[model samples]
Target: MADPTLKAALRGGEFIVAPGIFDMISARMADRMGFAALYATGYGTVASHLGVPDAGIATFTDMVSRMSRFAQGTRTPVIADADTGYGGLLNVRHTVQGYEAGGVTAIQIEDQEVPKKCGHTPGRRVIPAEEMALKIEVAAEARRSDDFLIIARTDARTTLGLDEAIRRGKLYARAGADIIFIESPESEEEMRRIGGEIDAPLLANNVEGGRTPILPAETLKAIGYNVAIFPAIGFLSVARALEGAYAHLRRNGDSHGLETYAFSDMNELMGFPEVWEFDAKWARPERSQAAE
Candidate 1:
């Protein structure tokens, strides 16, 4: 079943701030931080897993595998991005079921065409709003439980305009989406308009360098957004950290002076203590048997 905690939080009227987690390290780290949820970001996952862009090249299997790993490894409820549902209506149904079975608490599906680009980027196109509404209906029906939420995203704001995006958001919500995400509203006023117009729970994309102006959680909440996902923060920070560490190593041949996550702490975070305990328990019995 889906994690009821996420659904409860959404109903609780508090704004949720979900950080993007792309890998086990990110997942485990965020899992302990007490965030309301973790977003298994499609862009970060594709880049980290396949060394490729999030340009619809990653298949359903590729994305779902990562989603399963994230959900299994982390205690926090995960909201995974299912880009374009990977195909048509049948694909949408299958994707929802696959994600639910993989232990994801929620899945965000967009209205973009196949070969979908990132929401904040250009050259992206969306299918008909009616077609996307059907996709949402199929997704909602395919889930085994209502707790497994369906977040409907419209990429129409950047391409068609804010008016069309809002229209699609309302349509998708009526079609059974639990949350409406009108992606990439450029200004605070546009966001406010979205919040006032769309009666359903809304999601704001808070990409650092993307088209949307990054708002404080309080501002987002006051603007009537229920969730704000910072999908690029973790990976972008990691990228900079790696660059600095690698540059230092190349120049000075040592990482001794640099600040880093303690090696032992990392081992513990990754569950090495359990492995050690198991080894110790088994080794003692084997050694005793040998002596006997």
Candidate 2:
């Protein structure tokens, strides 16, 4: 469906795994791996693709291009990150319209100002609650898919404190956000508090090794959060392994010294042969090469 976020919100309280992806292949891999949802991770996309932080460095066009890739690659819906909606109210409105055009089912817009830092980073600042409320209104107004969801994200708890965050969350809820994500609640008590107070459906970003508390899926379910996205969980592990392999190769003269997942298994897992076959068929390979 064009607007997947609506269906997801209507499902309301189901348990679904949202794996993050940086590009088309990774999004396809997540769908193949049995994930029902995909998270278009700005942090991961910026870092993996641009080798930098998610500090509002990426343009609206940049973010939506990746969203298009993720949406096109999977049957599952994508919940994309429209980091601070790229600018003020007008900019946010434009951002939502662009994402809808890209076929994003859902997207999260934070309250951080322009040139904002990642939610995980310190020294973050939010526009006044009233200003962000207007931005949320613009987002809702711009959404063509009624089922396409608009998630309002607040970085206030860490920046301004939990009380202010809760107040802002209510303001966003009042403004028309289908879902509210109060990023990085440090304690379960705060989590419970937000869950108890926020009237709308809730989504959580539970990145492994992040500053936020890592609650189990069941625990989050009980706490009243509807969706939990584990962004960078796989990336962190992959980075560690890749770094270890490089060090091993430099020190031991080959990567064979490190015990690792077998190459055949990894290729099978990545659908290497299938991809090669798919590539070869349409590639119009040279007759001699094909015969050989």
Best model per lDDT: 1
Residue range 1-292, candidate 1, lDDT tens digits: 5899999999988789999999999999999999989999999999999999899999999998899999988888999999999999999999999999989999999999989999988899999999999999999999999899999999999889999999999999999999999999999999999999999999999998999999898988887899999999999999999999999999999987889889999999999999999988877556768799
Please give each candidate's TM-score.
Answer: 0.97, 0.88
Report every candidate's CA lDDT. 0.94, 0.82
Q: Tell me the lDDT of model 2 at 36.
A: 62
lDDT of 2 at 52: 81
Error of 1 at 164 (Å): 0.4
Per residue, candidate 2 scores C-alpha lDDT tens digits across 48-154 of 77888888888987787878777876778888999999887788888888887887888899998778887877888888999888888889988887887889999
- Tell me which residue pairs clash in candidate 2: 6-147
